[model samples]
Target chain A: MSPQSPNTKSLVEVRELTKTFNGLTAVDHISFDIYEGEILGLLGPNGAGKTTTIHMLLDIVSPSSGNVLFGGKNLRHHREEILRQINFASSHIAMPFSLTVEENLEIFGRLYEVPHRKTRIEQVLEELEMTSLRSKLARTLSSGQMTRLSLAKAFLTQPRLLLLDEPTASLDPDIADKTRTLVREYQRRFACTILYTSHNMKEMEHMSDRIIFLNRGKIVATGTAQEITAKFGQRDLEDVFLTVARNG
Target chain B: MNGNRIHALILRHLYLYKRSLPRLMEIFYWPLLDLVVWGFITVYLGQFESGLPHIAAFFIGALILWDILFRAQQGITISFLEEIWSRNLMNLFASPLKPGEFLAATIIISFCKVVAVLIVSVFVAWAFYSFNLFVLGVSLIPFILNLIIMGWSIGILTTAIIMRYGQEAEVMAWGMVFIFQPVSCVFYPVSVLPGFLQTVAHVIPAAHVFEGMRAVITNDGFPLPELMWASGLNALYLLASILWFHHIYDVVKAKGILVRVGE
Candidate 1:
């Protein structure tokens, strides 16, 4: 059985969650809901606060005035408990440099308190086709390889809610496709609810149940792949993103 | 952070040190410098006093304890700066790990380093200057609180500063260690400081730590009140530092300092 199958009910509900800097509001009171067994992709232009919103939802950035609910509780109140049930992967971050991939996974798995951590680590390594990279230091991994390791780490927590911030950002198209495939496979097999942000429109259109188009930190539009493309009078989701960025 | 996670991070750092070159610098070279440079000075002064009864033994312990506490202070936030340099601070912060985990792991790791430095410095003192912490080990518990607080306070304050200014402010983390080493009564009594500076010297917490250590070793027993005062001062520093750190953390995080720093 997959880790997420049991929690296929509505698992995350972000409400009017806003974050600001100085006088400028960054994530301006955006509200969204996420259910289990589905992938929701967040698409936005640079500086649109897509990453900021994700950071707040993951408890990385504190909200200015609103609540982010996770597993039916306010995230700030049950922060650790909520965190224990979620994991995140991003192309933009890296783990410890001195530790090998295996060691990094060991530390995170131990932190995750995964039962039979060694077996799980091996499982992830096998699944990701990364067993050869296990003993390699994280700093030494190619960007593509690091992305894979990050997905492995995200899978470690066996989280009900998995947040991916441009997990394939900066990857070649082939690797990006493979990365997306791996993430989708993880979701399909584990039934993990993925809250994702991606610049790659095709990837988002392919994977998301609903793609949220965010502009100036608010969800300007959200719908199925065709629903969004038709509303924006665009051929694809990428055009919708451009319309939101330029006109929203 | 949960207990198991904290334990896991602490063990990871400890294990990392056992496996890394920088750990060697912390565990071996840096403390060796403390012992050798200061050991020579004490040895040179030895001829003029030449083991002035048990008083000389107390002074030897005073020096060793001084090095340990200062290094304990040094260990606080410098590593956090390294995290910024390597851009790993955000990675850890963004993880499931909480702020408290970073603080606790830092303290545990710094304490371990301090213990290692103390052991080596004591060996050097006992070998060359007849100062034996072995005889004074019973009084170590009170001393432990003082150094641990100093280390944690320095760690928090440094983390705050690093969060604001990145790696450039890292030296400020260790600034007081070498800067205050001279007047902290590490080498001599505060009485030796020219009148006004003596009063100023007494205010820095390590002055009290050294004085308390000297009292324990020479006075033949632990001085509970004085040690408690030292610990209290360290606690106050730790509290203030943590508050300041959290404030800065909120500000920078809201402003996306973590992202800018990474860029």
Candidate 2:
């Protein structure tokens, strides 16, 4: 029931994107299209270049050779404009420790030039159930609360492109489930494109509309969870992931 | 490029000082302590060094101005290091905050910090040794500006090095200034150094600044030519430092080191 039309255009176009560090390649000539309003899960095992691909999309890491186009605009020439429509969140990084949660959110909101910031911040806080912790220092927050805050910051801008790296990693099951639901709800309400990465196979099956399986900086498979599992003659996506990760 | 975004960047650092008691204490306390310690040393030395006139003002004023330069440089470097410490550099760079805006905000924040440290040092010098840095009057403005510019140049270079080499180069944040100190001729005159070192010191804007300071304190009139030389040299250094930072920034991006900085 997405608002996107059957003829919806791609939001992100990656053409032979590759990244090499020193003598080693992290992402090797990967090409894909993320359609508007689709959840594209970049799935892979450790050192599969999943994170490196995400970094390229975010322009945090440069490609050794290739191009990424957002809305038909070249990322090299239109980075700030393209990035304005993109937002990213990760549990691996934390906000400034001394600033309160509200302060942190407010600062990020201002940086993004989010309109109606006060109302937007409050709405995001309420949506994430972080209203009570708004005044608490970011450093003092529990891990679960910090994850919630990270999600809140991502949702604050109502971005057209959302990049998330292991958004639910290390979360308790209850909170992880809730986080997934929140992400789904945010996507539903905003119809934003999501490029999500996670080690949780179940989460991938549940969340991603299409999955790209990468191994050793190359894409080994691309399909829906059921499609991938069926192609590999496996009962589930986890088995398919194990097959690809182990053999490739 | 964006004013509001730059303000947000500054606000992040300001909030750190606001909430942290130790951070606030460190700002005013260290300068005060340095002034007190140096003031007593000057007093003790003044009784023995009768050959040098206005030796007390020269030493005390030199200490305060030197601290100004150090604090200005540390303000930017330490604030950037804080981002690394808090694992916030990636977040800031990823946002709409352009690198130039980030540098501008850091410079403004550095000015605020140096002013705080300068005020405390000046107050302590006046209270303890009756050293009035303002006696040099309007010429003092150029001296302060020249030293701050030089400090910022060094700071920009230090940050670029840290960005390129990661946390391993963090020691440069504190150590780099003292490397310039000897060449800067902060505590002594350029002539006191050997001829070769004096040649090296002349290239440093701070050498001219200290020379100007000593000239003013000894009733030699405002060192206009020295101020002009310091200003011209510092302008070049500031431009070079900024270019160095941008160069390193490009390299850091290509190398994919930004995300791994704090770790």
Which candidate has the highest DockQ of all? 2
Q: Write the per-residue lDDT of candidate 1 for residues A1-94, one digit (tens) a residue.
A: 2223555566788888888888888888888778767788888898888888878876667788788888789988987778878888888887
How far out, in Å, is residue B20 in model 2? 1.0
Tell me the lDDT of model 2 at A29: 95
| lDDT of candidate 1 at residue B114, scale 0 to 100 | 82
TM-score of the A-chain for all models: 0.94, 0.96
**Candidate 2's residue-wise lDDT over B1-263, tens digit each?**
88889988888888788889877886888888888888898899888957888887788888888988998898879888999999998888877677788899999999999888888887778777888888877778889999999999999999999988989999999999999999899988999999999999989999999999888877789899999899999999999999999898888889999889888
lDDT of 2 by residue, A110-215 (tens): 8898999999999999999998998999989988899888888889989999999999998999989998999999999999899999999999999998899899
TM-scores of the models, in the order given: 0.89, 0.98
Off by over 4 Å in 1: A1-9, B48-60, B128-131, B135-137, B179-183, B194-196, B215-225, B246-248, B258-263
User: The CA-based lDDT of model 2 is what?
Assistant: 0.89
Alpha-carbon lDDT of model 1: 0.76
Candidate 2 collision pairs: none
